[model samples]
Target chain A: MTAPAAPQTAPSPAAAPAGAPAVIRAIHLSKVYELGAQQVRALDDVSLEIGKGEYVAIMGPSGSGKSTLMNVLGCLDVPSSGEYWLRGQEVSKLSEDELAEIRNREIGFVFQTFHLLARQTALRNVELPLVYGAVRADERRARALELLRQVGLEKRADHKPNELSGGERQRVAIARALVNRPALLLADEPTGNLDSRTGKEILELLDRLHGEGHTILLVTHDPEVGRRAARTVRVRDGRIESDAPNR
Target chain B: MIALLEGVRIALQAIWGQKLRSALTLLCVIIAILSIIAVVSVLDGMDLYVREEVAGAGANVFTLRRVDELKVLTDLQVFLDSLGNPRITLADWKALRAEMTLAEFVDPLRSRSGDLQAVRDGRSIRNVDLQGRGAEYPGIEDLDLERGRHLTQADIDQRREVLVIGAQVAETLFPGVDPLGQKVRLSGRHYEVVGVFARRSNVLGQDRNIFAILPLSALFAQFGSFRSISVQVKAKSLGDFAAALDEARTIMRVRHGLRPQDPDDFNLTTAEQFLTLWEKISSGIFATLIGVVSITLVVGGIIIMNVMLVSVTERTREVGLRKALGARRGMILFQFLVESVTLTSVGGVVGIVLGFAAAFLIGAFSPLPYSVKPWSIVSALVIVFAVGVFFGLYPASRAARLQPVEALRRE
Candidate 1:
């Protein structure tokens, strides 16, 4: 299978204006995993470009390269080979510290599992990113409350993850991801753990956020979810099958 | 500062969440620290008391004997060689008293066995150390008299049957009535209780209130041979104390010795010499106790480290989330370190207060000299804090080095 084509769109506002064509540009990105001497190619030379303010959905079957690609894009893993530039900074070759700084300043992640700190209140969970960014206490608290209010969790701000419903917890997670006002919001099956009605609510919230000009990348196996994005990319057997604008 | 405060808030929240486990862990640290502080404070207090008592008794007076006088060296050979056949007799005292100009008083002491019965309203006391000395004994030693007259020259010269009873003896024999001029039977001999001596103060271990004194000549006639004699002297000034000691030594050597090469006999002890010996013994005991206490503190520090390691492991997912959000490894390290240190420091403060309470209780009820030094409290705090930092480093580093992916995977 050949690598996928680069994402096509105009430059995003969050991206640097210093001659950068896209917010994220991946060329021949590949990741290989060795499990007990069994070699598995998770991502086979995937190349893609995602412009600023673009809402893209990545869909694939089980064992497809979507998760690996997401890991690479989020700077949580280094590609086995190839160049990946985040906002014109070559993230593939960045040091661990540099990668951490970029992760703090450029990307926000929403996991399939709400992943809120069980011991912390919703407000504290949202403040986690600002803590990493070394934001002052007064500013961190004020901004965290603002994000909680944005997610309509102001009344439930003091409740812990276990005290909240799946939908509310996910909303708190979303609030946490957007607290630092990151360049991109990367959501991996954000609604996977919720009921259908709660999942619809989450999708509606993401749809609202995208409409409000937030750059979003959604990874899912569901076609209905994919159709909501501005563009959809399909992957199979460690390669992209198609990349096109959604109807 | 904000980061530190955030770290503190997070740590408190985590500890509050696991209340039982955290309290149990803190209990271990508190016991360890308490043990150390208690032992050190008591020892420090005892040392101070010993020094003060010894110094008050005398610090400039040095005893001189034909042999080494301070009891620092105690061998059979030294003792035998030091105490030769030449005893400090009455004639020797007379010669030394006349020859030594710096000698304040040369009082020859002799012990006698005499059963005294002071019949007041029918009760009598027994078994007192009946001591006898010359007329100069009370003046040279500065003995305190509670009532009645001391031994006079006429009493010694005329060999009068008179006596002075210590406070304990007076209380026992006389009860409510005064014992002065009352006749006491001693070794089947009758002697009048001429005076009641005051109770000795600030003395350790022995009761000075169970004794009686008589004139030296009278005691010899009544009982007989004495083995030892102590010569008490007060120098003209502090600067002349050494010179007076030297003069007394020369006179004693001349009166007791045969040839120029022969060593004299007798052990002379001054208040200063006794004080030094007491300090040496007390310091050795204090050092040994401090060593054992320090071991407990070390064990406590190790327990803190172990608990912190467990905490770091339990919070792996939380750490991962923070890291993914943008926390640097240094921030992670700092947060964990602060938590561990805060735990130990709190335990230390509690331990110190507990130590002071223990010391106070001991001082109130027991004769053991217990005083808490301010520096000791400060030292305890500093040492415990250092222990927290030392033990916390490994676990904190482990947390800081955790990979976001691996940590999240653990969850």
Candidate 2:
């Protein structure tokens, strides 16, 4: 394990005020995937908006189009038709390169599988986003270190995914997602692979990050994870069912 | 770029994770490059050895003979035709020497009197390559004497029983005593030792030194008339070699009374002919080598492409994750190329090292002075990289073109 590095001086993009401009706005968006015989509408006629300081949970059971919605929102996929705006940009119409840039600069994702590169250590995993961002090596190291410290995994910076516990690996994943200081932290089933107690610990960490004013879009089927968010949007059979405040 | 460094890192990790697969993919390249480097190294060494040997004797020197060796190799008709041609006799050598104007020296020589054995005080040197030559033979060849002197014109004309022994012959005949002014028996006849030629380079073979020289008069007197005699001719200057060859050919033709339509009965070949013969032989070998090695490399490349396709398929989720994390298609493509290239480049390096070692071992045990050319090494490396990129293209593009959402959704 390498020595714990000094923290980054660049502040995280987590200081949005309430009622700030909406960072994600979708208007009647749809996504269709063609199978051999059937046309699978993974997302259909969904309209939604997420503000800069909002903590929103998108919930749906398996094959409910919730994953597709998260993918589209994270700039990993574009809608088949309809306008989708991310941070005032029409993301639905963006080219692959532009979408990649948006994903690098504006969206940070934590996947259900942890998605940490198996060969890389915790520090290198966190440094990945900055590498895509073309950040200098020294700054990448410092920022990844700061994110690791923030996630309380500073001492485990050099530990590979296999060496870390499930919850600890998720923490490292969280640090990796935050390394670029992206405006949107999009997590897909952040606790799907963790035990109930570890799941709660991950939720508490998300809660603390939300308290710091970071915009979060959590995708999960679990009601417990949804309840932790300020708002919940439920989807079923490729269409939005309800959008309501958690209170 | 950071992308390149990261790509290399990813490739190395991929290779480490699947060593057996990578080694299997690299097998063809290794074998192909190894054989090429080894053969080319030995061949190149031999080439240098021949060229140096020829150049030492002087490139402008040529032998006038009854049959050309290259003609025997390249033409079936010439082989039959040359066999019927008249043996160039002492009379012909005398005529050419008297008539030639451009030649600096025209020295007649005769060999293959392999039956002759030299003895001094009952210490005989057997298996000697005894050559009978005119006095000017020393001028046309690189014969440097260590003691006494070459047989002079007076010695050749007066038919003195004078002999110039090879270093090997002198060593065997005179052991501890100076060979100069000593008497040796040749074909049961006594002859005075005129000179001892310097030890020749043993690069080709040590057997080159086991020879003795006798004046044509003395040899003819002792061994009777020879079958055919060859004359060594040297140009006045290196630049006048063509002119000298033309003059000699024209003189010989006029003397033989040959018509312009008829091919000359005598063969004219220069030291360069030896080098050219080697080149012809090696080029045939080289072409066949290229054919086999290229097929192996191409087949290896195809296998690598197949393996890369499998690798890309296996890493769909990882690709998707990287794409979602902001890796562009170009980055994905470049990373895979780096992987393929690293695999083959590593093989190329190993093969080259093995080739050098093999060449060294072969040269050590044999008379071959094996050496590797720098450009062959460079070209082999370039070939490795080129093959990798060419073969890696399809698989890398396949990985690059994947939609992140689709890829991420793969179970």
Best by lDDT: 2
lDDT tens digits, residue span B301-363, model 1: 788899889999999987887777777787788888887788888888988888788877876
**Span of 10 residues, lowest total lDDT, candidate 2 chain B:** B112-121
B41, model 1: CA deviation in Å?
Answer: 3.0
> What are the lDDT figures for the candidates, one per model?
0.79, 0.85
Off by over 4 Å in 1: A1-18, A28-46, A59-68, A79-82, A93-95, A221-224, A232-245, B60-86, B109-130, B137-143, B158-162, B183-187, B201-208, B258-268
Clashing pairs in 1: A7-A49, A12-A52, B115-B186, B115-B187
lDDT value for candidate 2?
A: 0.85
- Proportion of native contacts found in each model? 0.65, 0.71
Candidate 1, lDDT over the whole model: 0.79
